[model samples]
Target: MATYKKRGYKPKKEKVVEEAIEETFDESQSDVAKAFDGLDEAANKSEQWIEKNSRPLFYGLVAIAGLILAYLLYTKFIAEPTEIEASNELAYPRTFFDQAETAAGVKADSLYTLGLEGGDGKYGFLDIASTFSGTKAGNIANYYAGISYLKMKNYKEAIEYLSKFSSDDELLGPTALGAIGDAFADINQPKDALDYYEKAANKQANDFTTPLFLFKAGQTAMQLNEFSKAESLFTQIKDNYATTQIGRNIDKYINSAKYAQ
Candidate 1:
């Protein structure tokens, strides 16, 4: 028979196991504490930075607000009042332009001269155009100056002022465009004249100005020996604007172009 041996716990090995577990738990606790400390330092630094920079950012915003207020005040108090004053001075020139439109030759010349000289006088049109370019009167002055120059046969000056005169009114817009065509025609640039005349004709597309400019365009094309283009323009006017004077005469223009060809 074999005798059974008794199993016994080893005190030294148990103590060594307990010590290893204690050491591992201590290291884990230390690592957790170190992580928490690092997070606290980062939060403190971020707060410090925000505290240091907030005042400058706030002042910068205030400065921008002040500048905006200053600009608004300047425009309202200074620029707008000056523009109003200048607009009041344009009445004389406008009246003269209306007069010149109805009159002819000598009468027209006198009216235009008055307009031009008055525009340069104490309550001059130039003063309004220069000082109150934001006003309707200023824009009209540019138109008046351009038309006056055109009447004087100063094509270059006419082009300059006409180019400056902008309008949304359909009649005036087409009229200005037509005047440019007239100027180009006067300068003997037939091809350029044809282009501008076509532009004027097509600009607003009304019965009054459209057929008239189209007729002028056709004539210009005929002068430039562009028979096909002249024929096309005259045909368009005849087909689309038959009741108009130019449209009624368009057939004659077509016949002339065909004969020329």
Candidate 2:
């Protein structure tokens, strides 16, 4: 009770600390205003740099556009027309090839020679393949060239031309594949030869060529000591083309394969 009569109020120190904090905040606001002004100046400089460099950038873009247009025009106007002209020039060689197919011995040889010789000029077979590579006749000439090369026993050249010749005709396509097998066989690459013969046999599957190639493939497999493969091929001919000449001869190969095994 005696202490309560003398009690009096006292101000807290926290109000002074709050006043100091408010003063620091006021100073920090001025610094923030100065930083924003510096950012505005940097933005102005960036705009100036872009404006100064825009003309060169636009010129570079225009030059690239012009190069693309020139290339397209050159391909369309110059390259395509030249190809058409070259294809027209290959007509005679094609005629000679057709004639050679029906002619016999010396006459066929002469026509084939003429075809090869005539295909040599500026618009010749070689030129047509090189220049008018898009034409059908050019491609046909390549096939003829390969066949001629094969007959001449120029196996390497035959392979080159035949590799380039592509067709969907059932007879010619398998025949060409068979010729490649023959060329490989001539060079004594038996494994590669066997592969191509099998490919030829399976490609078109005609009674004329398929059984013949299958027989050849079986023979090649026998040469390579692959008795099981040879037996399989022979058995396929026996089962699939039993009336064909190769089919009739299949039993001999089957026996030979079994003997080798």
Candidate 3:
């Protein structure tokens, strides 16, 4: 049997399937076009917002740049020069202070005075502390001045200067705190002495300052009739710092504190 067919003819089912595929493609293309239109609209809005805010953004950037420049200039010119000058000025006073530490009687007092008051047109610790307050040298001047006052038995001034000074140095920081405690103890403020002594003991735990301050705190606590705290601190010295000088006698302190309780 011979099947008759027209030219370029397809089956009915094939024609129907092709028509559906073309319609689906048209719908997918329409969806893609809609998505592109939505993206373009959003991009236009972002551009408009950026354009509206461009002047403020530029000024903000300029402000940040100006702050950076100002900081650099200050560090290079004012801060660096002041630090150098303060260090130079500190040398003169430090010499007298060192001499005073080894001297005795009226000579020691005179040297300390010179250290505080300055000579030969050089600035003293006091002057450096006031003039270059933000500099490292100036900050150390406060520590020196405080120690001088402490050695001079000027307890009030010692406390004042020591309180003004701060440091993160393991030795210096704890030493300064302990010095303040010494001042408080000399002034008969047992509570304040105990407080500062404890702070010094805990500031940075080490072999030297830690046991030293702990012993002082224990002694201060004993004075305050805080027998338990005193006993605990003394025990810490006996346990941890047993090789140190104060540690050798810490057992007696612990016994005394325990008996007092």
Among these predicted structures, which one has the highest TM-score? 3
Query: Candidate 1, overall lDDT?
Result: 0.84
The regions of model 2 sitting more than 4 angstroms off are 1-88, 98-111, 119-122
CA lDDT scores, all candidates in order: 0.84, 0.83, 0.94
Query: Worst ten-residue run, lDDT, model 2?
Result: 1-10
For residue 23, model 2's alpha carbon misses the true position, in angstroms, by 56
Tens-place lDDT per residue, model 3, 224-253, is 889999999999999999999999988889
Off by over 4 Å in 3: 1-39
Clashing pairs counted in every model:
2, 2, 0
Clashing pairs in 1: 119-124, 119-125
In model 3, pairs of residues that clash are none
Q: Per-residue CA lDDT of candidate 2, range 143-229, in tens?
A: 888887676577998889888988888898988989999999999999989998999998897899999999999999999999999
Ranking by TM-score: 3, 1, 2
